[model samples]
Target chain A: MRTVDPAKREAKRLQILAAAARCFARKGFGQTRTADICAEAGMSPGNLFYYFGSKQDIFAAVVEQDGVDTEALFAGLSAAEPWDALTRFFDLVVDLAADADYARLALEISAQAHRDERIAALVAANDRSVRSGLADLVARATGAGRIDPGLDPTTTATWLATLVDGLFNRVAVDAGFAPERERESLHLILARLLRHEAQPES
Target chain B: MRTVDPAKREAKRLQILAAAARCFARKGFGQTRTADICAEAGMSPGNLFYYFGSKQDIFAAVVEQDGVDTEALFAGLSAAEPWDALTRFFDLVVDLAADADYARLALEISAQAHRDERIAALVAANDRSVRSGLADLVARATGAGRIDPGLDPTTTATWLATLVDGLFNRVAVDAGFAPERERESLHLILARLLRHEAQPES
Candidate 1:
């Protein structure tokens, strides 16, 4: 019967999500339990249920949160120069791929997406959101003469998304692939792929 | 007490692996039962057990077969011109990615690799084999003046492998990404990435 503070409620929600993310990354969705999530979050089962109904619900919330984060990132980049924004986005990918938990969580979610229809829908929606964001940036860059005029923005964006997906895949499977060390090579590849005029360093 | 024909026995073992691949692709590793594999292979449980100890064993054999197939492919390409061999390799990739079953099976295997250490070891060994094969091709191309001298063969090969992994990922996630249609774009990207003098068409 007591009134819950809105800000505190949101903070508690995020805390639960962060803990669930770690549990999902370490044990995978099939193996992770709600009790484990509650344990990780240092919350009671009753408090955890106040935020999410079931393990499946919590998993769905995790995917939905990723979409929200990605949208927020694009919104922040919207005010920057188009080419710089695109490079900044790739740099962030390098950083995320460098994080072991984030990369493993990505793989876990993707693997679950194959078997769960709900997860697949969420993943596909997230993928579309990412591609559309890239397409908008590509269009802006092309209009500004920073990218090749001949390349279709949508197609270019899709290929760029493929590169991002590939980057994560490399981190998951290859032990020797260091995302930080490959940052320069990634930029060089991007410049070449987009046919940018100046050298990647310049 | 009866003597078994070794060639026939080997052929039957391959038959079971092929059937298991289909079952694993369709239902994923966790959901696929040994009984389902038997039904798919048109064999009794006893016959299936004669060749494999469990679903895990059959899955491992499928991964092992991929390594064998890859080694055979590189052996075939070794006699060709370096650039020509590389292009042929990419062409075959396009063909394989176009197959829904193969692409789905790849995802399944990769997903399983995350939870299973034995599978992880096999996948890692196979990945190393693939990268080494690519490095050899890149080295030959560099020595023949077909590739830029500034590019290190191993690094270049690693990125090229990344593209392959990315291609398969696109197939798994993007329903709109048609591998056959993207063949030309892939070639162009490769040309630009490798700094090949001639256009992809030439």
Candidate 2:
């Protein structure tokens, strides 16, 4: 029996997914070839195919990876104070936006979701994960009296989700937009929306 | 020599553009054909081609029309009280979001803007028009002491732009999301972000 190291195999898979993401972000699903992903990963086509069967397959993996990442993010956030966790969530997005490739990939995934059902479903699942995570935090915070008890958790979660989406959309549309610069204002908006307290920060 | 009536020509051009918007909204730019636009407009390919050399041409025209329409919207809002003008802008977006086709087309155009430079330029222009219009109103509002004097018009304008982008995104991701249902919350967010006075409405 041939021995395949599971850890090594998983690492290689992640390596390929990261490289594929960069290429997809730069070019787009329809325009990028499987060969292109191979070149990005510095692997032979056979090795790449050993893991991902086609370009579409690789694309699906990338989206699935995003869902996994979101799950992991909320996993970490789940343990923290709910209001702080919610604020920290925006901070994490600001960090993500600092990497233009990551930001652009988000836009690409959204664009591709409009065209492909599988991708759309994956995107929706990822979105649901985010909204539900935020909603959970909101419910916790509301119960703890850390924020406005009058705010509906589901609705508040939806708006927070919108701000996150809009943050990426801002990067996509405006070249002059710097997400890092907007962090202060983002925090202010959240404070007012969820905390009902004015954050007097410039 | 055949004489063409200028008013008739202009009206026909608008008719074609409206039909093309529907097709692009329904099928996206790449999937929609010039023939589709012509069929939707109830015109022959020759007639469509006479007005637009290609699908790309009509797409550009639709984007250009959006800019023109925005200019006309701001032209009317220019005379209103600045804070009210800003609030009405959100009202206008809520109305547009009520039409699924119109809202979907906005997302489609944004997605297409990612790949095509010509489309990107047009979309950028449209964003600039929106941001600048909002900025002008913010400036007037601040000067009139209707808003926080500390607020920078352009920055406030950008955040408002994000909200608008987020609104369209919410529609795209959540099937249960009704823009009409969101109108009150949108107003609440705006009031909190801009009005400086805490809006008692949840």
Candidate 3:
């Protein structure tokens, strides 16, 4: 057998994850099969197995990939104003929610996370990362005295993260609920929470 | 057959709903069978069918029963001291979260509400009722000058309701996340949001 190229292996892994995400989004985790993923990826069962050993592995990889992509989207933005950063975060989340397939996948993962320990742990880890990142941003803003020092950054971060999750679920269920309205409401809420006195410098 | 008594029929309907709630709590909506509900109720499947045409019907009844119970729980409460009413609301929610079986049932319904239109409508109706009740409370509170009059009662009520939902989900996922701790934080957050000047009445 020829040696597998590293770049080719990485590409195949991503391909399998994308296909698996689509399958999971459509049929749900319980109904989806490895064969279905293989067909979706246009790859043989052996090739699919070469990248992910099992269905759970494929799921974990998909979640990991989502986290990586989200992190990259928000990376290297230290110079931006606090309000701008918050607005960017809300816009990114709304864009994610706009995709029906992605939203379904997220709901499936959340439902499964309730019953499965491994999935719950994965979700918890991902949630912690996001919360910590947000807390860091809050802390920086606090240092600049943009937010009240009395408020706990970590708790506020957790609350904001929870709001994001709730907003995503709402968007998934209610088609009439406009993301623009939500984004505006969130900006106002964040401004109030942060005690921002000046007009947001867009 | 003997003439059916209206009161007795209503009682039986309530009984059936209770049994269905238990079954849904144990096995979830998707996993629960009509037979499972019959077994839970110690009745024949035919009897269960007479009471509810299908599993979905029984699920609907369970939700309707919950709505009635919640309404009764909040009945006769004037919106006088909306902040106090709001605190009481959170306390009641915390108590409900303490009931493990009910908490599971709520989460199951919430998850199913995402995929099923019938369930979604039922949940939305329930949400609307609660929000209106909360708005009444908020209006009274605003009238008493307890909370900031600048904030719209409906919007504040909606936000409060969403906060409870987020807190309940967190409590379900992490047993260590104490409802009491979050309740304290909620009180603080609400005080700030409402711009309460005096110390919150315990």
Candidate 4:
């Protein structure tokens, strides 16, 4: 009749999610079943069911894991100069794409988001949250007259988000593509795109 | 024995690819079996084997079917005005994303491309072709004094390609996301990024 500690319960849930992510990454969502998740978690089926109702629920939880708190990642970005803040965000994405398993899981979730409404909504919300944070940073930069004032913050934010996603796909598929090379290219592109200068002297 | 007509054989291969694309889109590559593809294509397993060696080969053939014909798609793009050509390219992508099944198939291929090297190489090659085509267009545009003369065409091409991929993800995931709306937003963002003069104050 002892009550379980809330912190202890939450910790267990996180442990389950971590294991589930590994299983999902190794074998895609369609191929990974609840039993596989249980085996990966080192727990019995009953114990795993006690935490998540079904395989899809476990998948939802795994996709929602706080792998990268995009908001928190960019929280202090505004303090830096606009160009610096933008490049920092790009570098963070490039670094994250280096983890092959994480990248695989991301690609799987993206594919699922197309068919599953709930998952799609969840991913869209996360995408908006990240874009809003970047938009705020862009707005601040524009206010400070660092970026072209004529640029729409939301549009620029979306453009930047797209750039990150594309880079992730490139990194995930191409083994030889170096993140350092992409980062340098991105810095130059962003500088030329945002600055009003007509011609950047090579 | 009479020889089969070459045109008829080629058409039959295309039919098989189309059916495989549908099956892969509906049931992912892993879940799909050779029998399933044969059934979908209304052919016997032996007949399917005559055309494709295995289920994986069928999947690869299906993916290869969607190969980006850069030469065909961008034939006159370099000769067009810079901003005009870029806008047309973006518009064409938006149009393509409107075909839900095609977009779904593309997403599925991208997801599976990571696990299969042949598929990965195929996807990468398509990416490179598109990037190269965009680079040529960007170079033409810059040389014609459309874009910033000093901007690197390759980098600009990469960013442009990234934007298209990101937009495709958005269209695929968001049920309420209209292709027109997404395309409009993209146009605005690209115009700003390319430093094209904004539509005169109205």
Question: What are the lDDT scores of the predictions, listed in order?
Answer: 0.85, 0.84, 0.72, 0.74
Q: What residue runs in model 4 are displaced by over 4 Å at the alpha carbon?
A: A35-46, A66-68, A74-87, A195-202, B33-47, B75-86, B188-202
Q: How far is candidate 3 from the true structure (C-alpha RMSD, Å)?
A: 4.8
Residue-level lDDT of model 2, residues A31-75, one tens digit each, is 788888999999999999888888888888999999999999999
State the local distance difference test value for candidate 4: 0.74
Whichever of 3 and 4 has more lDDT, that candidate is 4
TM-score of candidate 3 chain A against the true chain A: 0.89
Second chain TM-score, each model: 0.95, 0.95, 0.88, 0.87
lDDT of 4 by residue, B76-122 (tens): 67667866997898898888878777677777887888777898888
lDDT measured at residue A64 in model 4 versus the true structure, 0 to 100: 71
Candidate 2 off by > 4 Å: A1-3, A198-202, B143-145, B199-202
Tens digit of per-residue lDDT, candidate 4, span A71-128: 5777768578866787788788878777777777777888888768878777887788
How does each model score on TM-score? Answer: 0.93, 0.90, 0.84, 0.84
B-chain TM-score of model 3: 0.88
Over the stretch A7-110, how does candidate 3's per-residue lDDT look in tens digits? 98898889899999999887777678999999999999988887878999898888778778766665754567865676687787777877777877776676
| Residues A33-61, model 1: lDDT tens digits | 99999999999999999989999999999
Worst 10 residues of 4 chain A by lDDT: A193-202
In CAPRI terms, model 3 is classed as: acceptable
Q: CA shift at A99, candidate 2, in angstroms? A: 2.1
True contacts kept of each: 0.33, 0.34, 0.09, 0.31
Worst lDDT window (10 residues) for model 2 chain B? B193-202
